[model samples]
Target: MTLSVALGPDTQESTQTGTVTSTDVLTAPDIPWNLVIWNDPVNLMSYVAYVFRSYFGYSEAKANKLMLEVHKKGRSIVAHGSKEQVEQHAVAMHGYGLWATVEKATGGGDGSGSGKGKGKRG
Candidate 1:
């Protein structure tokens, strides 16, 4: 898919000590976010895998792996990028009739539930 983003010109304000304060630097757009796919009753497992393969261009093995993650763990972080990028991905996933959302990347857990027990099927 072709994506076009029009970025505005850079602007920086001078501080009292002759230091520059750029909003771009302060509000860094590079901060990462995650596209989370939630498991649900409506969609079939194979369909979820197909969406992953077709939309994200994931390999068959990778697509199945992520799909299973969603299946067993209740959710999975399928993709990560800047906030806007993941938000766009979430929108695309929604378009495909999948339950999806975006959240700031915490760099901690793998965005899965504890594997100690099986998850309830809806």
Candidate 2:
């Protein structure tokens, strides 16, 4: 008895196969995530706005608007992306002395649909 096998485009086949079944790997798409900046007593309002501007490349008006939201709402979703992306942003925010976190986006949309935008200087 002799056996032969063939590989075809990410699949395997056997010449003496009893059952040739192909299983397609269904990979889940990357879920959307949110980078939330929380209100903190230590950081000044201006500093937060500055971070938004310098780091996120947000316009002065937009930065101030988001900063105001963080101040009043106690928290604001500043950026949206994949989980890893948002996590990196969170770490960067921490380095800037800003309170930040990452959360799975609601409804899989770009966060809460409020203050929905992302800007990177680079």
Candidate 3:
């Protein structure tokens, strides 16, 4: 009796027929996560911006930008890094009485649904 095997178009089979390696098996690391602060009834916008400036050391313009993103879009990514980093940011934001959470950043781009709003107290 005889047996035969055929490899796919992209594969070359050795006569010895050892294991095959797939290029697709390897992938880049997961995208870094982010700590997102959402606009909420409980926190003031000025406080949120101040927290960004004080804790994250963001410039006034940058802090105001992120704060505006949160207010208008309903949410904005306040920090980015590994899960531990994001969690730390979230905790610190919470300490400041802001609503924050960690989430995986969308693939290769900022995810949709962030709104736009001018800076205003609360």
lDDT (Cα, tens digit) per residue for candidate 1, span 6-114: 1101100111222222323324454446677888988999999999888887778878977987887778778765677778999999999999998765433453322
Q: For each candidate, what is the lDDT?
A: 0.63, 0.62, 0.59
How many pairs of residues collide in each model?
Answer: 0, 0, 4
Ranking by TM-score: 1, 2, 3
Give the runs in model 3 whose Cα sits over 4 Å from its true position: 1-30, 107-122
Q: What are the models' TM-scores?
A: 0.65, 0.65, 0.62
Model 2: residues >4 Å from true position, as ranges? Answer: 1-27, 107-122
lDDT of 2 by residue, 9-121 (tens): 11111112222122233123334466778887889999999998888877788789779878877777777656777799899999999999887654443333222223211
| lDDT for residue 104 in candidate 3, whole number 0-100 | 62
lDDT tens per residue, model 3, 1-122: 11111111111111122222232332333234657777787688888899988888777887887788778767776666556767888888888889888866443343331211112111
Cα deviation at 57, candidate 3, in Å, is 0.2
TM-score of 1: 0.65
Q: How accurate is candidate 2 locally (lDDT)?
A: 0.62
- The whole-model C-alpha lDDT of candidate 1 against the native structure comes to 0.63
Q: Provide C-alpha RMSD values for all models, in order.
A: 16.2, 20.2, 20.2
